[model samples]
Target: MNIKVFIYDDNLSRRDSLKALLELSPELEFAGEAINCSAAVQDMETCFPDVVLMDINMPVVDGIEGLKTIKQNFPHIKVLMQTVFDDSDKIFECIKNGASGYILKKDPPQRILQAIQEVYEGGAVMNPSIALKVLEYFKPQEQKSPLSEREQQVLQLLAQGLSYKMVADKLFLSFHTVNSHAKRIYEKLHVSSLGEAIAYYYKNLHQ
Candidate 1:
């Protein structure tokens, strides 16, 4: 079955282009398109999309709030955010709020298609430039990895965009134990949020 994609971008040209692109791809179907996400929930509920192509910067309701609403209501639907530039703060916010992927507006068509597929298949994707910005956004104050071997393993999985539960299952550890290691990792890294922790992982621990 083709993955259904809904677009939420204010740019008419971009929306049109995306619609045309979707028509060309056998793996994707254009469920619907919207001007903005002001009615994010209603739109998603109506369109019944498997993945959403969300524009991060919209006029009335930007992707951030729309992402929040969708994740809150329809946790299974994947969202892939696109922006004209690598806005690190927005990127951090989106990731923290459960955005499945982030990509540049200027990225080639093939990459965008690949991102949608990857996210639909439960993998997190980030533009390389955006990934670099995410690391620089939270430049660790310390380089030393205070994390134990288990903590490092947990963090590495998290960095790959695995959820805590997924990491626990992959490592054959209880979910509560994984949570404990995550908490310890945060305390040791002097970071307090998921986005910051992932950034710290890339900055300090990622090989």
Candidate 2:
């Protein structure tokens, strides 16, 4: 099925470009577009889009605030942030506010489309630099993970780019046991993916 996409951006040119791109991509459908997200909930409800491409800077209500509102009202709809700014603080804020993905505005059109598809398929997407920043941003926080020691060990291995099988072998555990530990770690960390769990662990590792 084609992914229904809505756009929220203050720049007329950007909006037009996005609309044109959607028109050309067979996998994507243009649901709607808005200049800003002052009435994000209303606009989103009207469109009922599967994904929203949101710009960070806007008049009155910025993308971060708009993202919060949209998530609050329509938690099922995925929101991907598109912005020229790559500030760590803003990126973290958007994630905490429930944004599904973050892509730089300077990214190629194909990358943006891939991000939308990734988010729609229940995967989180971010620029490689953004991912590193996310990991670095949490390096100084106190550890607050509720995972057991075994789970922590598994997660640590996972964070070091180990595959599940590799982690299991290193820890002298069965594959099922390793998978179980990873699942528990995700639950305790309130994250959905290994990347997010690693980010959370780094943030609270000092504790």
Candidate 3:
């Protein structure tokens, strides 16, 4: 199957170059291009591409914010961050905001095509350096995630500044059961106090 893709980047030269590179693949088709996040959003509504190649440093709403909007509104569209910088902060922020891949601006055309196909197959792609950073950052998150889904829901509600009674009412469960869920959530998250739990919740709200 041919994968349709949209390109978003501020630089005209880079955007066109990337588009040219993507066209070389028989399995990939260029859907459209946008100069900024706002334009990208409009293009997405019209074209509905399977994947988006986004640049991290754009005017108005940067790639990170743009990515958040895309993931929230169009969950099926995979986003790949393409930037010149290989810094860990940008990589982590992009992944946290639901980017499916990260490729350096200098990466070969074949590599970018491969990254697109990888994400299409439900696998995340990252530069080796960025991959290492991702593994390091997510290790603690995985450790905190061993809780059941109900427990997680209860913890999320409580962390949103909701009282136990409110959470129980929202979940339609007894206060005692809600309390048990909260307790288990705290234990699994390795947090000793409600404040700590809330802190963790705020920290990992996306995951």
TM-score of each: 0.68, 0.67, 0.65
Cα lDDT of model 2 by residue, 1-207, tens digit? 999999999999999999999999999999998888888988987888999999999998889998999999999999999899889989989999999999999999999999999999999999888999999887876645588878888888888889999998998999999988888888877889888999877777634
Candidate 2 lDDT at 166 equals 99
Model 1 per-residue lDDT tens digits across residues 1-207? 999999999999999999999999999999998888888889987989999999988998888999999999999999999999787788999999999999999999999999999999999999999889888877856565788999999999999999999999999999999999999999998999989999988877777
Show pairs that collide, candidate 1. none
| Highest-TM-score candidate | 1
Task: Report lDDT (Cα) of residue 114, candidate 3.
Answer: 93
Pairs with backbone N, CA or C atoms under 3 Å apart (clashes), candidate 2: 138-203, 143-204
By lDDT, the best candidate is 1
Model 1, runs deviating above 4 Å: 143-207
Ranking by lDDT: 1, 2, 3
Better of 1 and 2 by TM-score: 1
